[model samples]
Structure formats: C-alpha cells, structure tokens
Target: MSSTSKPSSSENIVAQKFDRCLADLIVKSGVGFSAGVIASVILFRRRAWPVALGTGFGAGMAYADCDRSFNPARIPGTRIIPASELKKDGSS
Candidate 1:
C-alpha cells in the first residue's frame, strides 16, 4: 500500500516564532525581575521571595504565549472553524 499525502504545515518549524519566543522570554522575565527588585526594595524589605515569584509569573506568562503561538487552539476564547463555515453563499 502506498499513500501520497502532503506534509502538514503545522509541522513546519518557523524561525520567526522561535526568535519571537526567545525575545519575549528575555524581555518579560527581565521586566518582571526588575519590577520585583523595586517592589522588594520599597515594600518587601529586600526579600528574595518577591523576585522569585515575579520571575515565575513572567516565565509562566511567556510559556502561555509561546504555547498559543505554537498551537492557536490553546488560546482562551478562541475556536477553530472549518473552511465550510467561512463560505458566504454556502459553496465550497
């Protein structure tokens, strides 16, 4: 038996997404860490927990965004619609 099927586009590795993901991870985590440092100095008496918490939150957010980019269906309040549903006049 032989099957001729085109490879799925989703399987393709996109360089742009990787670059964006890396940038987001760096920027967001850095921002979170900075914010935590400020908060620690101003309110938390320079404790370490705040910094760690902030970094974790930033990383989690980045992970969510990356996941959504890789699989759009994982995004909240989003759904996948088949091409048939997009037709205006009920024609394929």
Candidate 2:
C-alpha cells in the first residue's frame, strides 16, 4: 500500500500542474481574444488578423510558461544538482 501510494502522490502533483496550465491557457487566451475584438472594432476596421494574432500570442506565452514550469533546467543560470551530491548532502 505504501509503495502504491508513493506513485499516486507524484501522479497527483502532475495532474494538478496540468489543470493549472489548462486554466491559465483558457484565461489568457480569452483575454487576448477580447482585446483583439475591441481592437478590431475600433482600430482594425473589422479585420481578422488582430484576432488571430492575439490568440497566437496568448497561446505562445502560455506554452512558454508551461514549458518553464515542467523543465526548470531550461532556465538560464539554474544549478542542477547531481543525484550523488543530493545523497551525500542528505537534502530533500
């Protein structure tokens, strides 16, 4: 039971992260779409490009953020500790 629960706990964390990412994507994309609609009516003269551009920009930002969250080492100047060092240092 203990062994089974350990993997389940890690899976739960992954599920939570995925849920957060999905929520962020929806919210950011919705805001961008609203902004685009406003701009289209006022500035673009009912053009479609602004709407598409805004959606892509929002999605791209969300993707970047999600990638960063999943891969901490991808960020610049992040120190990656080796497994051996972690064991030696006795750090969690």
Candidate 3:
C-alpha cells in the first residue's frame, strides 16, 4: 500500500481544524478591533475605552451569528462531521 492511501491521524485533523478556527477568530477579531478604533478615534473622542469595548462586544456577537449562519452544525447540540468523512462513507 502506498503512503498516500493511508488515512490521516485524528490528531492531524484536529490540529488542522484548530488552526482554521484560530485563523478565522483572529481575522474576525481584527475586523472588530479596527471598527472599535475607528469609532473611538473618530466619533467619540472622550470615553474611548467604553466605546471601543461596546463595539468590540457587538462585533463578537456579529461574528458568532455569522459563524452559525455559515456552518449549521455550529449550533448547540449538533454533531459536526467533516465533509471528507461523509464522502468516505459514500454519503455525499
């Protein structure tokens, strides 16, 4: 059997998923942080910290909603199997 035919380890799959999730989170956080900076620096010169915090919270909520909208399995109480596994089962 060739090495390419071997199934990937679960640890590798998990690590990949973790990396993807972290990357998504960082991008989302940056967008939120930028919005916060804009609002604090431009609109509300005083109380910048509070405004930034509030906007950041709003951004986080938006991110959660957006994430759920994109991936239905992200909702609570649901099992999320990767598409590759489904394909392996001939279900796709």
Candidate 4:
C-alpha cells in the first residue's frame, strides 16, 4: 500500500468555510479602514485632532480584528496595505 496521507472530508469542508469567511472579513475591513482614513484626513485638515486620531485608531483596530478573525492562521504583524496599491491610476 502507498504511504500517502489525505485530508479528511471534514477538514476540507472546514478549510473552505474558513477561506470564505476570511475573504469576506478582509474585504469588509479594508473598505472600512479606507473610509476611516479618508474621514480622518478631512478632519485633520479641519484642525480636528481628536476626530482624526479617533478615526485612525478605529481603522487600526478594524485591521487587527480582520487579521485575527481568520481560522487556522494568525497574521504575524499588523495588516496595513499601503494606499498606493489601491490607487485607480495604478501609479505607485
């Protein structure tokens, strides 16, 4: 007999579910953080330090939450994708 090991059916199902959940959370958290940053920038321009700081902190927390929400994994560091990657013009 061959000595190969295969993942059980339940393991495959669990992996699929976890992947779907992770994708959804990533999208949601990314959007939320983007909106928060934009709002914070506007507030900063208006000389509202409190509002700006609060919004920035919220964005960081959201990112942390998304990183931890995934199963069978832990993001080693903070997830802060640079805004340049999200630009429409694709100019970095």
lDDT of each prediction vs. the true structure?
Answer: 0.85, 0.85, 0.71, 0.61
Candidate with more favorable, higher lDDT: 2 or 3: 2
* Per-prediction TM-score: 0.73, 0.79, 0.52, 0.39
lDDT of model number 2: 0.85
TM-score between model 2 and native? 0.79
**Candidate 2 per-residue C-alpha lDDT over 21-61 given as tens digits, one digit per residue, 9 for 90 to 100:** 89989988888888888889999999998998888788888
Candidate 3 lDDT for residue 57:
76
Q: What would the per-residue lDDT of candidate 1 be over residues 1-92, giving only the tens digit for each residue?
A: 35986754643556678788989999889988998899999999999989998888888888889988988998789988888787954773
Best by TM-score: 2
- lDDT tens per residue, model 3, 9-74: 988866776676666667766776777787777877854684558556755776686667557788
Candidate 4, residues 1-92, lDDT tens digits: the string is: 56897756987866876676667656665666666567667755644554545555655665566556643257566565568766855764
Candidate order by decreasing TM-score: 2, 1, 3, 4
Q: Report the Cα lDDT for candidate 1.
A: 0.85
